[model samples]
Each structure stands twice: as structure tokens, then as C-alpha cells.
Target: MRFAAALTAGAALIAAILSPETALAAEAHELPGAAMSLWWVLPFAGLLLCIATGPLLFHHAWEHHYGKIAAFWAALVIGPLAIAFGIPSATQAVLHALLTEYMSFIILLFALFTISGGIFVAGNIHGTPLVNAGLLLGGAVLASVIGTTGASMILIRPLIRANDNRRFNAHVVIFFIFLVSNIGGSLTPLGDPPLFVGFLRGVDFFWTTVHLLPETLFVAGVVLAVFLAIDIILHHREEGAPKIKDPTPDTKVRIRGLANIPLLAGVIAAILISAAWKPGVSFAFQGVSLELQNLVRDAAIMILAFTSLVVSPKEFRGANAFSWGPIAEVAKLFASIFICIVPVVAILRAGLDGALAPLVLLVSSPTGAPDNLAYFWLTGALSSFLDNAPTYLVFFELAGGDPQHLMTELASTLAAISAGAVFMGANTYVGNAPNFMVYAIARHRGIKMPSFFGYMAWSGAVLIPTFLLAGFLFFR
Candidate 1:
């Protein structure tokens, strides 16, 4: 019966996509009007189907391999939809928006250098309370500048490697996600993709920091306190147990590759340049106004920064122990997300495009807040399971319709989305792009990581209450 219903729905989507009204409108740009109506639901269904098929598909595989299956299913569903409905030119516009308008490369490059620097100087500082505290602190701070993914890739493996001698370190990584990977991205546009989209749409960049600072600090402080308590308890357990003689250190803790400071500065400059570039042309392309200046700026900066990274030497990354695996993982997962969600994004764009005023009213508060922080939390919750970047763009375009509300509201709401997506991602390994990558790498090295539901339990116990507190404090 369910299969029959899905077939009917699929047929209806085909008709909707091919409807004469849409076809004529989309002909010039080849925007795949026929595929747009049902794009969102298809991948969503595929995600669920993959979850449902888990037992049959990877029964013999390790539990962690479920994500690979999920990624596969998502891509499989995306391929047919792309062929049937994709408009390459419009798709290029979307990609341009993603790359240039959002300045994603800026964030990626910033993360590369920042993570490398953190690893280079602090990589060996593990196993002691001081080192753990520093890592947690450094990770939190870095999360704001480089993003949760950047911070996690640079830190998680080294952290696991450092604490290999301890039996009670499982919970440490769990809490690490809460603080460093998820919650910390709340402060700036570079911290989370959703907020960056908001910025591209005209939300003031500085306001993001000002509006979200309080909530971010609160979450970080609480998570840190919880982590410390757990660490103390675990540290004693290890101390009381047997200890093996340790090998002597080869070199002291002095910072190596200090000369890379210029390269590091170059990375930051590249990010600033990319982000500071503004789109000058605002004329409509296929009925949608292209923010050309902003797009140009974002694309240029990202290109330069990444190009610099490609040209730099191996010695500059020595202490950081930088490698390609984590970034490759991020690229793979994001590729899946980008392709699978394209239809969904286009569908949402079409649905909400004509209904902007009403949609804004529907999402807004009684005060007619230009944008509501409440919507951020709702989207963020769903984003924990789905993809947050496109989810962010969905809400961002919705918010762009209203120009009358105070700019502060827009900043606050965008910040809320950023916080919610990054933080709640700790709820499940699959919640954020890098969460599972960290899990896979950690487990491969023999860390006894939590299961999907197990991670959720941790989030429920620790992060959820904190997010609720943030909602009351900020969203209201």
C-alpha cells in the first residue's frame, strides 16, 4: 500500500514538473520545472528508505558503515532526478551562489590553516587534564573561526591518538562534539554555512557575532563544565589503574614551522578578501535577481586561498600533522548533500517564491519580527537529520522577502539557525558532515565510540537542555 502511494505521488510530481505553466516559464533557462516539484520529498524519502533498508544492505558490515549506505541511496535518488529535471545553467547559478555568494571556500581555507596551526602547536598535548582542557577550549574558539568540521578534523584524530592509553575517553569525544563541532559555530558567519547564506542575503556580518555571543558562551560554558566533571572522574580511574613506562619525547613543545606564519596570514587574508567582495550587479537572471558583486567576491577569495594551500610546503604543516582524509570525507559527504538536495532546494525556491509575504508572516512573531529565531530552531532540528546548508538557504530566501523589519532580527534568526544546526549535530553521528568522519577515523584507531542512538542520548542529557535555555534567552 505504501509502495502504491509513493508511486502515485511520484506520478503526480512528474506531472507537476511537466505542467505547461512551469515548462514555458522554465524553457529559457532549462530549469527542469518538471523535476522541481518533487525534489525535496524524493531525497527525503530516499533517506528514510536507506535507514529502513539498513538491516538488509549492510548486515555483515560494521554498524558505522550505515552512513556509507545512506550516502549511496541519497546519490542514487539524486541521479535520476538530475537527469530528468536538472537545468545545468540554473544549477550553475546555484553552485555559484554556494561557492561565491556564501564564501564557503573562505571558511574552508580558514579551517585548513587554523586546524593545521592548532595541531602543529598542540598536537602532542594530550593525556593530561591541562591538555584536554586546552584542546576543548581551543576547539571551541576555532569552531567560531573555521567551523565545526575544520576544528573536528584537526582535533579528533589527534585527540584519539593522544588518549589511546585511557579506557574512559569515550565520553570525552562525545562532549567534544557538543562544544567544539556543534555549539561553537554560533558566533560568526564563517562558523556555519547557514549563517553565511544569511550574510550573503544582506544580514550584517558583525551583528551575527553580537547577537549570538551570549547564547554561544552559555552553551560552551555549560558543555565545558560537564566535560571537566567527566574528565575528572575518568582521570582518577586511569590514575588508580596500572601504568606502563612511557617512551621519552623526541622533541620539546616549542612551536615548529613558525615560518608558516606568513602562510597562515595569507590564509586569513584570503578569507577576508573572499568575504569582503561584494556582488555589484543585482539585475534579474531568468526572473531571479543575481547578486553578482557578492558572488564575485566570495568566489575570488576562496579560489585564491585554496590555491595557496595547494602550493604551500609540507614543512609548514609538520606540527599539525595535516592530512587529506578528513577533508576528502567532507567533500564526499557534501557532494552527496549538494546533488541530493538540489531538487529540494529548487522546489522550495519555487514554492516560496510567490508566497514570500505570507510565508514571512507565517514564520514571524506577533511583533512582526523581520525574521524569527524560533524558525531557526525548527529548521536546525530537521537539519540534524537532513542537510543544513540547503536548509539554511531555504529559510534565507524566505527571510529575504521582507525588507521592513529591523536588521537585528535577521541577524538573530540566522545566528539561531547556525547555532542549532552546529550544536544539535552532536545529537547523532550523522547529524553533521564531519561527525561521522570523526567517528569512523576514531573507531578505526580503536576508540569505543557511541552508537547513533547512544550519541542522541548524550545530546538529550547534555545539549538539548542547553539549547532550550538558549531559545528562551535569545529566541524570545
Candidate 2:
């Protein structure tokens, strides 16, 4: 997997240096999104649907062929696009997406996943309700610092170990997903992919911090309060039952692989530096412009991640039970998603003239103003099913792709979109990557994690009403 990531980075460098010019030209060719019909989006929808249903409907086939299924859907879009528009046009769009969007996205995820895997939280505490809540709260805070995936990977095993003796422990893991894996990631670009996508598109680094703080606090606080109440009740309920033995005895909690902490800091530093240091130098290939600072950021992050691998002990990684499978799956599936998103982005850019005009109107007020509440719900609804990053891009484009305007005049609208995308990703397991990863880790550690739909039932009963209150209170 290291070889694969290195090879990919090497290939990108090779491609950039080898053939610098092409018939695709320097300027981007615009696709006529307004001219396209609804059928153009079928492949995108197909891929998303397959992603949603594949695991449950056919676990064997999905586990084996999800990449192929994603490719098939992507090819459906790419093929017809080439025939409909000239090959150069299609090539330009897809290449731009790959070079500009997908490259940095996957690199950041890979770097974080690699670095976080090296840090082993090597002890556990007894699962008192207060202790469980403390861990969840601590993780929720840590998530904004080291990304949801990183935080989840670092803390989930310890969390599971803490709760192993508790009979009613699934709810703890579920709320962890709700808080740690989704809502907790709202404050920073380093926290989640959706916010990072916004950063790449020119959102200010502190924008979410300034704008979404109240909403994040409201939602997280409410959810935490609910968790405490339920956990207390469940803890009491377990008191009457025959005792279950604690497999992992509680010990003084210690963190192994302390070296990775600095590497994680390096990643955060790299992103901050990139945002601050715009050298105005860029490389152009097939009409895609790769900025110098972004290139340097990705390179620096990869280096830091690799450095963690070398610095951290092998036994620490084994103790952490780390594997590259989760990030690898994400890399493949998101590549296909980015390819499929080309025309959809074009359609969104067309605004009221496009096939998705109804969707646009649905999120708009009668006076044609952007409806903050509607933006919250609509972006959240799609985000709950499809991946939040792309779902964010969809609404970000819908709300007008200008980050400057979004930062000021329609700040609330952008806030709504951002809040929705980040917060509602907790609504289902498939909504965000770390949700399923945490579930998988818990189940492997012998915690009875709920089934996919059963997990949604948990979210539905808890999260939906919280979101509704938040939508009305903040967005309205």
C-alpha cells in the first residue's frame, strides 16, 4: 500500500514533467450543462445507489467488486460524455477533476490514515457512564485536530475495550459515530473532507470555526446530553444482570508511538502553510492547473505520513490493528465519484437553466433568496446517503461557487450547507468513511455493533430530532 501510494505520487510527478502540453489546451473548455438532460446524471446516481445498497444486498460481491462497480458506473458517464462532447472536452474535464480535485483529496486522506494508524492508544479505563462520556467528549474535541478518521482510528479500540464488559454498549459506539466521526469534524478543514473541499475551493481556514461554532455546539451538546442520559439508564439496567467478565482489564491509559503526534501536527501545518503561502506558480496539463502551494502541501503531508511509519515501532502498529484497506477502498471509490461528478458539476453551474432546476428551487425561497433552513435539510438529506464531500460540492455549487460571496453576503446559507454536510453525515453508516470503520473495529473487538439499517434506526431516533431543532433554531 505504501508502494502504491508512492507509485501514484511518482506517476503524477512523471506525468507532470513528461507531457506538459496537449490539444486539450491551457484554458478550460466549458461543458454545456444547461443543454444536458436529466439522463446525464443517471450514472452518478447509479454509483451512489450501488454504494448505498451493495454491502447489505450482496456483501460478498460488494466487498470484492465495489471498485469494478464504481468503474462501470464511471465509464457509463465517461463514454457517452466523450461521444456527446468531443474527446478533448471530455478529457479536459475529467483530467481537471483528477489533477485538481481528486489528487489532494486522496493524498490528505492517505496521509492522515497512515499517520493515525501508527499511534496506538495502549490502555483502557473501566466503562463508567461518566468515563464513557468523557472519552466521547475528548474524542469529539480531538477529531477537529486530527481529522475524524484519525481520531476514530486512534480512540475506537480503547473505547471498545473500555466498554467490553457492558451489556448495553452498542449505543456508546453509535453515539461515538454521531459525535466523533461526523459532527465533531465540523470546525476545521483538517477535520473532515467536506470542509477541506471547501478550503480547496477558497473558503477561509477559520470560516467554519467562526460560522458553525454555535450550531456545532448546539448539536454536539444536545447529543452528548442525550448520550449521558441513555448511558446512565443502561448502566443501571446492567447492574441487575449477571456480570460479564472484563476481557481487557483497566490499566493506566498510555499512548504508544508518540512520534506520530508531531507528524499529525506536520499535516495540519502543511495545510495551514498552503493556505497562507500562495506563490502564484502553477503547472498546467490538459487544461488542469495545479497550484504550487497545493503540490507542496500534498508532498509535505505524504512525507510526514511516511516519516511516521519509519519512526513508529512495528509492534505499535500491530497493537493498533491498523490496515490500509479502508483508505484504499476510499481512494478507488472517490476517484470514480469525481469522474462521475464532472457533468453534475456542470449541471449545477447552469443553475436555473439546468435539468436540476427543481432541486434549485426547492432550496430557494419564494422571493428567490437562498433558504438557509432548506439548504440545511437538502444538503443534509443527500449527504446522509451519498458521501458528504461530493454532496458538499453539489450544494456549494448550487449556492454559487464564489467563496467570496458565500463568506459574506450569504454567510448563513453557506453555514447551512456546511453544517448540513458535516452534521448529517452521521445519519447513516455509509454517509462517512469513519462511521463504518469504527463499526468494523468495534465488531471485530467483539462489541455487538448494530446492522447498517439498525444503526440508521439509532440515528433516526436520536439525530433527526436534534437536526430538526438545530435547523430551525440556527438556520431559520
Candidate 3:
């Protein structure tokens, strides 16, 4: 894989340097297009090619899971550097800038630490549908207070433990992701980054909550209904599994270490302060300040909040069966995702204005485009594979030109971006960072999880429809 990336880099460098001036000019001035651009399609094509050649290249290792490694190597190593040389200079500039920016790194680190905290806290929970649901409900509210990433990290292990007895508890975690980790956070600027971005764009923080609550409730209601039905079925299935006698009744329920609550509170306070703090606004400096603030807050929370975890007695930690395994898994796998998506994000941003002319022309048309549902679907589809944050930015910037119906267009566009990125993020193992964390944590606790393809089948059967319905309700 490294050799392939080196080859790709060599080819891209040759293309960039040796091409004629006319060719370079053609590359620079090429029509704004989607999918058609080599920048967008080439990497995907290479992924497919890698999948096809996986068997031939790895031979015996092919049977042992080499495909994932090859794909990862291609994406992390070859993907960015190749596109930097192959794509126009503009695309290269954005990718390069994002890589160097410590804000992105800090944001990612915060996510990592948040996962760690969640694993530790949630590990104490035992697998029971009621307990799990309670934990998730608490997580949903906490997510708004501490940030979704933080809540996810702090609660995921507990949620996993709460459902440990039921094999069919995927639905529990699925709904957890849908509600607690994603949609529930819409009400606060501290809740989700997209809303936070909106806050920075002149929208007041409280106003965001006022406007978002209805949508959040609507989504939550539907998800809760689905969860109840699935949990009932799983409960019936659990009756058939072997049951062990309880040796210690309710000993695990004792709240001996209630002191940790204050530490958790400290974490939340730090996050709120960080979110509210600003060095005023500057067109140039706003980006830098926001990014730096996130870093400071992330570090503060990790350093300060962990004191509680450390001071808690061994019994409480043992009851939760807490360990560092799940967070470690999340860190290892997500690095590939964060790095690989850089080029895809750059290409999407570069092309959003030019490609999908039918949609773009309409958005620019006097009648205005019909909310570009096609663009919504396309963005949603790619967002399933790419990090949805950048995907949201791509479409938000794409719809920026519609000044005549700016509010309506921007609202529709934002709705689509938010819905697509958040909802479709459940589509695969790598679809969202936390999805993999949940899966890994579940597996480590002896819960048999579906395979990658198995998970997609489940998602296709269930979540895809929910996503489609969400798109209709929100986008229209």
C-alpha cells in the first residue's frame, strides 16, 4: 500500500510539473462539475480498484482482513498527497491548510478524550433495557450541556453495559446515536458544531434552542417509538438465553462515589465557558479564535474532569468494568477517517458551485431551485462515507449564492446538510466515529455484533427509511 501511494504521488507530481501550460490552464478553468472531476472520482475509483485487487495483491493475507488495511493505507497515505498534486492548486491549498491547522487536530483530540470519558463512566452500567434507556436519556440531555462528543465518550460504555444482556440491543445503541449523540444536541450552540457554526453566523445561542426544539422533539418522538418496539422484541429473545444467578443483589446499585458528579459538572462548566468565550469577531481571526478556544476547552476538560475518575474508588470502576480498550480502539480507527476525508472535502468545496448545474442554476434562478433535493441526496450519500462536518460546510457554501431567497434557501440547504450528515452518518462502520466505538465496546463486552456488511443490511432495512423520511420532513 505504501508503495502504491508512492507511485501515485510520483504520478501526480509528474502530472503537475510536466503538463503543458494549456493543460494546466484547462485544469484550472475546467467547468464546475461533480463526479466528473478527476479530483472527486479518482480516489473512489482507486478505492474500488484496491478492493478488486485486494485478493491478487495480498493472496493469503486476503483471507485475513487485508482489504481494510489496504484501503486504509491508500486513504491515509496516498489519498491526500496524490490529490494535492493531481487536483488544481486551489484544491491543494485547502487540503494543505486544514492539515496544518491545529484547530482540526484539537477538535479531533477532544473527540478522542470525550470517547475515553464516556467509556469509563458507562462501563459501570449493567446491561438492562431500562437502565440503558435511562442512561441514554441522561446522555441526550448531557450532550447538550457538555457537547455531543463529550457526552458520547462519557456515556457510551454505560449504555453498552446497560444493554449487555440482550444481543438484539443494537437498536438501543442505534437510537442512542440517533438521539443522544446527534439530533438531541441541536438545541444548543454547545451541543453540535453545525449549530455552533450557526451561532457564530449571527444567530443567537438561545434563539437556536428556541427554533430547534420542535424539530428535535419531532425526531426524538419517532426514534423513541421505534426503540420501544425493538426493545420489546429483544426482551422476548433474551428470555431464551441462559441466565446466571445473581450473587450480589443491588450491590452494584450503590452510589458510593457520588463525588464524581461534581467533576462531571466541572467539565460541563468548562465547556460552557469555552463556548461562550470569544475574542470578539474578526473575519480573519474568528476562525483562529474559535479553533483555539476549542483546543483550550478540550484540554481543560480532559485534565480537570479526569480528577474525578482517578479519585473514584476501585469498586465503582470495577462495577462498571471500565477499561481503556474502547477509547483506544476509537483513536486507532478514526485517525484514518480524519486524514482520508481531507481531499474529498476539498474537492466537494471546490466543485459545489459549478457542479449540479440544474440545481445551481435554479438556486441562482429567479424562481429559485426546488431546494435541490438531488443535491441533498448526493450530499447525504457522500456524507455516509466522509466526515459529515466538512460535508455540511461544502453544501452550506454551495448554497451561499442564492441572495434573492437567502433565508429560505439557506434554511432548506442547512436542513439538508444537517439531516444528511447526521442521519446518514449511521450507514456504515466508518460512517461516524462513535458508531465504530459503540461497535467495538459492544464486542469487547461479549455482545455479538453484526459484521460490517451485516450492519449495513440492518441500516439499509431500518435507518435508510428513517433518513429518507427525515429528509422529507426537514428539507421540504
Residue-wise C-alpha lDDT for candidate 1, range 118-214, written one tens digit per residue = 4344334456766787788888898877667667766775676567677677887887777777777777767766666666565677766887788
Off-target runs (Cα >4 Å) in candidate 2 are: 1-28, 197-204, 390-405, 443-448
- Judged by TM-score, which candidate is best? 2
Across 1-476, the per-residue lDDT of candidate 3 in tens digits comes to 99988877775664354222323333542322232334444544454344335435664675455436545644533433434343454334334434433244344444445324433442235556566666767777777776666677666656665555454666676677666666666667667655555555544567546645665666666766676667777787878988754323333433445665566666657656766787554333312223456556666766654565567666665655566666555554444445444445544555544333443343343565546455557656766676666666666667673423433535555555555555566676555556666666666666666666666777787767776676677655
Provide the TM-score for each candidate, comma-separated: 0.73, 0.86, 0.73
- Candidate 1 global TM-score: 0.73
Root-mean-square deviation of every model: 6.1, 7.3, 5.9
Q: Which numbered prediction scores highest in lDDT against the true structure?
A: 2
Tell me which of candidates 2 and 3 scores higher on lDDT: 2
Better of 1 and 3 by lDDT: 1
Residue 167 lDDT in candidate 2: 93
lDDT, model 1, position 442: 66
Q: Candidates sorted by TM-score, descending order?
A: 2, 1, 3
Count of backbone collisions in candidate 1: 11
Candidate 3: C-alpha lDDT: 0.56
